[model samples]
Target: MQTAASKAPAFRAASMALPVGILTLITLMVLPIPAVMLDVFFVLNIALSVAVLMAAMNAMKPLDFSSFPSVLLFATLLRLALNVASTRVVLVSGHEGAGAAGDVIESFGQFLVGGNFAVGIFVFVILLIINMIVITKGAGRVSEVSARFTLDALPGKQMAIDSDIAAGLMTSDEAKARRAEVATEADFYGAMDGASKFVKGDAIAALLILAVNIIAGFCLGMISHGLTAAEAAESYITLAVGDALVAQVPALLLSIAAAVIVTRVTDKSDLAGHIGGQFSDPRSWMPVAVVMGALGMIPAMPQSVFLPAAAIAGYLAWHLKKRAAQPEPVAEAPPVSPDRITMEDVSDRTLITIEMGYGLVHLVDKAKGAPLVARITGVRRQLSQTFGFIVPQFRVRDSLDIDANAYRVLLGGVHIGGATIRNARVLAIDIGDVREGHAIEGEPTFDPSFGCPALWIEESERDHATAEGFLTVDPSTVIATHLDQLLSRRPDALLGPEEVRALLDTVKEDSPGLIEAIHPDPLSLSKLTRVLRALLADGISLAHPLPVLSSLALALQQTQDFEALIDRVRIDMGGWIVGKICPYGEVLPVVTLDARLESAILQGMRDPATGQPIIEPDLAGMIGERLARISADLAQRDTPANTPALVVQPPARRALNALVRARAPDCVVMALAELPTSQAVEVIAVIGAEEEQAEPQNARQEELAA
Candidate 1:
């Protein structure tokens, strides 16, 4: 047997009723409709207008009737088309009598206006003013403002969606649905802003049509049909006024509907229900009841009308007050069963986690295709290759305790770094010479990743900022870049015992004998991890584990100290390090310490009992200042082989590297023994030498350095 599901295809075809109706409306505009048909069409127009108004009243939200804008346009067109058909019949045969246009128009003109053409004309003009100036104008302004604010709030809405996904409050599909809803709302408001113009235009067109019918019909009756001026005026004026009233009434209904749709706030109840619920308060009704009762007792008032209304209001107030005094009933809960709990139910803490505020949730919402998840995956892979071990998976969640635009990164459950971003705006980083007099208008901020000066500008200004030599990035990219910087600096802490064992297990597959000979013999896995961590901390890549393992094997035979092992490995990996810093086979431009400074550093490093290099605080501060200056100057220069380097004696190289790592992390510190003999070196500048102490000394040193 055929069921509802099987008949769905036939039912679907019935959905085309609206399109068919619209086509009929257009046909009525061109073809001459019979008087009877015109009457039917006029009634249908009134019915349609009432239906639209009722729908607007019942709608829970603006988006619930997303097609209201299109429907309004079509309804206006239908009304105007009917007016055209009625006007044609009236002008061609209006001299016959008041009923020339149709029975519907004749009835409205005679019965509603008491057969007075002047009264009907006055009423039509009043309706036009109300629709054009009051309802349509106000609704249009509301739509315009709503559209602008909705577009402006789009970025914040999207960020909130992402923040929810990151916090595990919503799945990817749920987030996608919310994003689609936001876009649909913006589109609906924009269309409504334009559709409201149709109502205003229709009202103006009705007035113009009214004037044409009355003036033209009067002249045609007297001149062509041989009727007297009084007779023509009586017949034509009545019909013209009737036709205008028939169209204006329906037009007024549609205008009210449009106004209602635009102005209605999202609510769960219909218009009557909303009003009723809000008026449920006893305090509001008691004052209204007392005022009505006093008005009924006044001498001039109608006793029947005021007295009954006062009685009803007073009863309503008493009923509402009694209802308010009653206490609400509480729901009962089911009894809980006793059960045993164990430690197995809880999981261990994650190695790394990122917590974001509510506004930033959209960054990981899979529904919106947030790029942060993919970016984090890429970071893990890249860091894994650089640090010679797998980076642990990062956990992301939302925190209500933080600000909406803020996010924080944690390493082993400890807060590391984070920053706030304008999710609704793009960040434009100033890469060029951004001086004090620059005229760009925006919110001044700083780039979270690199601490560069930047501006948070509207998305519309992205192109202009790019043209002005600024790097523009979205909110997701800003967060990802900041995460990358944090992970790079803390790779040592990320490398725990589990990560070391995982790396060794993979390495054993290709070189089982090498792993067996080195591990647990002279070098333990724990000691090996420490040595690898030291190399990674200095910005060296261990993508290939073979060379590192081979160097360790030999170094372990002679010495077991991690510092000594790292220094020996650095000398063996010099070629690899050089290739990373400069082009292959290019001359290396380096800065060298003055002979006097090198001797003083060597003297400080000779004491092994201290376990770290010891120098006077003033001298150490001076050395750091000089190194930072040289590094910054080289970074700004336009040269092919100008990678900054500080070459020191072998004994003091490790000690000085540790001192400058925090102050000038970008400067590569090299021991004289680590430089390949085959590669040529140029002394670009000397730091802390006797040259700056004398006027002639500066000139002599420059000549010697070149």
Candidate 2:
């Protein structure tokens, strides 16, 4: 508290400095001053100009010295005010000789021009021409051109920053800072463009002040003091030139500073270091040395100078090359430490991540936790319960890499699926429920999840669409639904060693003995992880792990082989699997291939690695088409939950699973041996009886219904 109080007055005074300085400049222009005061003000003016020039030259980039333009403005005003005061003193006391204005002005008149007024007048004009015509004019043009280019490219630089953000290469705060820098750079250049005019005008004003002092002083010296023409001209002309010279020196310094500031390029170091590092390249110096050597050999050339310069250049080139060739020392990497970042430092720890475009960002209401985010949280909770393990927390981030209205789901940084949506519009999906040729008008699109026809319509039209029998879903629902569908298909993708370990840890609290039968005794954590993932792949959830674990323990009693163990586990869980489709009392709908077709497929091309026969693509396609027809027929029979199961020979079940997965994902493929004795089977279709056979999915309808 005491420190803050101490700083308050000093800080307030610093903030008031500019306004106070302006008032002082005004006072200098309006009031008269003694010769001593005039000399002190003159010295301060020159010091300010030199300081500004040093600051400009030392800046590595233009923006590093962003205050240069404002400094130039005040510095120009100070010079102009000094000119006004000096002109007054010179005119009023012309008969008093060279020191009439000040010691500084007197030094310029007598010492600088050797007591000659003719030479002093000529030298002052020359300085004025250089400041106005050369340095100030060039700096003005550079600043003007730079300002125009910076403004033109502003939009593009902002877009590039946005691109990096969308690509997940940079975060939001980095993007914000980058945008601020680009705006500041443009503003700096624009100010420099106007500030250059101040320097140019200052040069012109200095010339005019000299003219007034000389003309008025010359007349006043003779008319008021009874002086001769030679004496008046010597005294008046010399003093006028001296005062002008005093102002022009600083004006020229300021012009050079402006030029230096505008021309700077961004670099890691100050201007001197940047230029020095660039010239350190050996290839650049070698050429310079060779060119100098060639020029020195000419008889008309100045060998005395060129020969020595060439030798020096060659030596520098050799030194630079030696330095370049020296191998860089490898710095030892710091030992990995704890508590900073580790794996948790990664913002996205979720195995699953949703990246949204800028347009869809509004769907996530930060204060209310966003509608889409809420939906995703619900989906994750549902999936975690269904899978019987806590799914990792998901991350939702804004990305500019994708379409403004689109979003994508990434599983381990790999894009799974993405689609565009109307920001706040509802999606009217045609789920084969709408009437033919309905009058509902909207932007036509496809459902990202199901590939069904959908329309993007205004929220007001949602009620109308729903009334017309179309399923109306909001944009949040659309994205959430799409993500849910894609993730649900591959639940096994979400389970890793960590999730498996967590699952086993939970199981241990209840049945440590049961876990012991199938875990470390027969399977390690990695092996157990694979076994559980395989069960998940078979559509069996760990939600109720006891039945799955109980079945696994029984399977291990017969065989320790991975494939044989999986097969045994399926057979042991036969009753539980059939109960999902038939509900213990209901009759189960079964599909099978004819004797010859089954034999052909069972005896088809065998996999060299697994020895399971691979089904032919044409034969597989025919079976899939037939099964899809039967599945559709059963869907309308008020028994959609009892999706039909195909019972196949044990040896052929593994071979046929992939084909069914692709063709009829809803149909379950089961081995006949895996079926329970109490379950009743009604063969819905003999796939090859009429034409082609059934599709591939999985053994037992239990996985399908899970």
By lDDT, the best candidate is 2
Candidate 1 minimal-lDDT segment of 10 residues = 695-704
> Residues 61-113, candidate 1, lDDT per residue (tens digit)?
88888999999988899989998998899888899998878899999989999
Off by more than 4 A, model 1:
1-348, 433-439, 605-610, 692-706
lDDT of 2 at 241: 84
Let me know the TM-score candidate 2 reaches against the reference structure.
Answer: 0.51
Name the Cα RMSD for model 1: 24.1
Model 1 lDDT at residue 283: 82
- Supply candidate 1's per-residue lDDT for 12: 81
